[model samples]
Target chain A: MAALQSIKQNCKKVMCIGRNYADHVKELNNQRPKQPFFFLKPPSSILLPDEGPVLRPAGVNMHFEVELGLVIGKQVKDIKAEKDEDALQYIDSYLLTIDMTGRNVQEEAKKRGLPWSIAKGYDTFCPIAGPIAKSKITDMHNVEIYLKVNGETKQEDNTELMLFRIPRQLSDISQVMTLEPGDVVLTGTPKGVGPVTSGDVMEAGMRINGKEVEEAHIKVE
Target chain B: MAALQSIKQNCKKVMCIGRNYADHVKELNNQRPKQPFFFLKPPSSILLPDEGPVLRPAGVNMHFEVELGLVIGKQVKDIKAEKDEDALQYIDSYLLTIDMTGRNVQEEAKKRGLPWSIAKGYDTFCPIAGPIAKSKITDMHNVEIYLKVNGETKQEDNTELMLFRIPRQLSDISQVMTLEPGDVVLTGTPKGVGPVTSGDVMEAGMRINGKEVEEAHIKVE
Candidate 1:
């Protein structure tokens, strides 16, 4: 498969799942949610590999969560659980991405029962590596996703750890909002999420069939 | 100025302010936020007048919020309050828009400290009328924004009631997220917000200089 081109212009929204891993939920000291919870990031927040350094908002403790990304190839709405397999046809490609968050600000918003836009929607808050066609991965469940900061492994997990897998997650989200072509869905990250600061070098990647399929190098500014 | 053309394709994101009006805060029984809080909707959620009827999700209570929409004409980031006047140059046009929401879903999400994307981002959730050039209004603060359900006025308020005016709101938002050309800012809704059912007709408009500068007629499915 050829390398995936930048989908910034085609991408309309970045939908993300929250607390999809039991370890991640326990690490954050958060109760298990009854259902798959989702949030959004504007297209402007997408930082491609060649887009330069990621801007770290001054004085804010920003954290990073690495996850697998699914790019929709067709429009879908009101997808049903029974037809989850059919929904997979709509996914054109997959990539490795990061969900950057402002920890203190998000905590404050949660305490006040406010929205999470300011905490999660900052510029350069989302970064993605080159994409691989969906056909490249023979077994989605066996893929390994990991991240390293400053040459030290920070997060290491597999897709089998996700609480809500791709099919169910996509179906649940489509029931609320239509999934259009180029829209990216970030399946929740696993445990070991931590904060990043200025001048940090981060590497995230996905391994399929014992080979690196997708990877991204991000420099914090 | 000619009737404002539909900006659905040009709009990158629909950014909204919450609890910006004192009366609205009292009506919802929400405390006045010390700082402006915001949420987002995808550009795909935008439904133009010519696009047809607004689809109401079954089993969910839907509500309408009329607001003045600012269409960004230039890119801006980290704008300061002192430079707010200059920020106005980036706003090329204004229009009337409805922030359709799933109230029940939103309330539930808020209680659980979850994101509000599902509640506020259903397809056809944002209905926008044609655009009115910014120069058409002599004083943005004095413009009247109102909504009528089936020809009966439900909400009537002036922009002067907003807690954070355009300049300050823009400055504050740009500090966190980059405001790109064609992006929109919904300055928040006034009091008299209520739910609407299928088969209802919604009329929302903005009165500038005692004249209806922009208005939209939406039919609920």
Candidate 2:
């Protein structure tokens, strides 16, 4: 893994998995999906670490869920995911990202069977950090993901707790939507999700064996 | 536009409107939304004019939705749409496109309150044609849109019937998701949308005053 390019320039779509962690599903009172469930965030919503603050829409409850972001390295479709290694080859790098949500809007959309684009796609909503190559982490399933707001830990979880792991998610998603190089996949968030108001600062990161591999600092305004 | 580049290279995301026509709403038994409703289609699903074919997944009921595609000329956000004129400046070109959907998958997702990504994000799901410059169409709202499957008309309607016109859709959508250069906004489809299977050839296009301005020839396989 050498120096990587900026995601803002290379990425196309942000394919995201939802409810991959059972506890997070329980926390949201959402039914655990039988198969891998997913949604998408537009590339327009991608905000680099130094781009600017994430604007909290007026009259909307904004929340943050930190997760590991996989950068697809090649064009792949219908990948067989009998083993994690099969899907791992397609990932060239990773990032730490915050999937900011309009919680109030999302709740209404969910209840009314509406698409979540508006709820999940405000400008600067997705703040990203690190394209740490896949080689940085020896085991994809053994890393720790954490997020803090105003220096208070709100979310901390291990990837091992994921209900539908990366391999299955990639394989299932690729079967329907072709995974192209430069495309990103946000592996679902963990439990302990909460809201963040204006003037709040969020610090999210990924760690391997207690060593911080990547982190993102974001502000809400 | 002077012979525009391929959409697969220039496009970032396909922001689409849903239930924008009264007749289409009645046919689907969906309530007319008070505001503009939108969803996203990844750039990966974009199939250019010379691109091969639209592949229908096994056991999926695929339906064709012909629409007027607006190509954003420049980056715009929070566009005011008290009138369509206020938003028309953002559009540089237009396209005739079909929003292929997995009707069965969508119906189930709608029933379970799930996201519609899988139902709408399949490869070759978005087939497009024509970058006919904005100058070609005298009135955006007065254009005629129609689609035929195997030479039989399945959908036919006029943009004048749109519940929420383009300007309003763009203005409302830009308020949430920033529209960028090359990003496309597919105005919702009309009534008489039916199933398209393997070996069906879909010819969809837009017209003004009964004269064809643009057309798309898509083969399903």
Candidate 3:
């Protein structure tokens, strides 16, 4: 197996999609958003493959949602949705990554109308795979993403099911903040998200045209 | 006047306090939070003092919030509240910064139980002055913070009014995410935050023991 490429040191931010998959939205009982909703995780939250175990915070219900990660290749700001094709030119690569969440804490925050920082921004909460060049995936809308916990498949879906596609997401986000080189965007997650416990081994992977493009593994501590 | 030192390049993450001042909370008609509420802005959002005209996004009601900024000098993780005094040791400097916000967007997000990224993470939304060594201020808890728009005083208060002081905020945040060198923490704003229109000149400053310590100005474009 090849060594996993870490985006930790160079990554400036982790922009995440919230409730982008229809099934996942239904499962979580969340309203379908009119526009793409996003939150952020600090670069310090990134846990590289070489890093040993993913620490599960005590007394919190930690859940895992695997999503496709896009690495921005150039600077982008105030990009219009109609010019999404030009915005696509800013993407450099893709990979599989986990958006770890403290589900219970998030629910509490939502109830109180507070920001979701502590629920989604803990250290080692984001685990990513080695990068696969953007050219490797010819169809951005049809790739498959999956996650398995303790060898049991939990989440499996195709990018075709996303409520908001990559181009629109990038364009919309660029309109808000500039996307610089090495900044990451997690393109939402599918259904079947569930809890993970200490001593569990998790695997997340991506496939294009039925060919495995990238995968990563991490053990819970 | 000396040239303003820029932390924009080296800054990793910006952790912000929400509703930390009682007067500000009342001014916004928000309930007092039992614990500190935080949101994040990307490093790319940072605009240095000398960086000319702060661009105002069209169709958004942009607001200015002046707060005390803390620059972490050492690594911190999983620190306890009782050890907050030790956590303060990691802070090397302070500055006055604008936590620029999109008021309408944030209200909409709060109503939908969504994150405040787009509301608080827009490019050039965070304008910071050059850092002041922590040693310069004899009393961190009693420093004065003030902001002016078009030469009219808008916000004025002392750090003594903050519900969650610097040590508690830093210690609480470290328990979730590691505070690395160059990471900044905006310790919430005081009352009198309001809108900024094009052509407006905004100035924010801080004083310790009635002596001006740091101040910076930017024109709204």
Q: Quote fnat for model 2.
A: 0.79
Candidate 3 chain A lowest-lDDT run of ten:
A212-221
Judged by TM-score relative to the true structure, which candidate is superior, 1 or 2?
Answer: 2
List pairs with backbone clashes in candidate 1: B4-B131
Candidate 2 vs 3: which has more lDDT: 2
Every model's DockQ: 0.75, 0.82, 0.80
Show the lowest summed lDDT stretch of 10 residues, model 1 chain B: B212-221
TM-score winner: 2
B35 Cα displacement, candidate 3 (Å): 1.1
What would the per-residue lDDT of candidate 1 be over residues B8-84, giving only the tens digit for each residue? Answer: 66677889999999999999899998888899988878877777777888878999998888888878888775443
Count clashing residue pairs in model 1. Answer: 1
Question: Candidate 1 chain A: worst 10 consecutive residues by lDDT?
Answer: A212-221
lDDT of 1 by residue, A24-113 (tens): 999999998778899998888888877777788887898999988888888888777544366568788877889999999899888877
TM-score of 3: 0.94
Which should have the higher DockQ, number 1 or number 2?
A: 2
In terms of lDDT, model 3 sits at 0.83
Candidate 2 per-residue lDDT over residues A161-218, each given as its tens digit: 9898889999999999989888889998999899998888888887788887733334
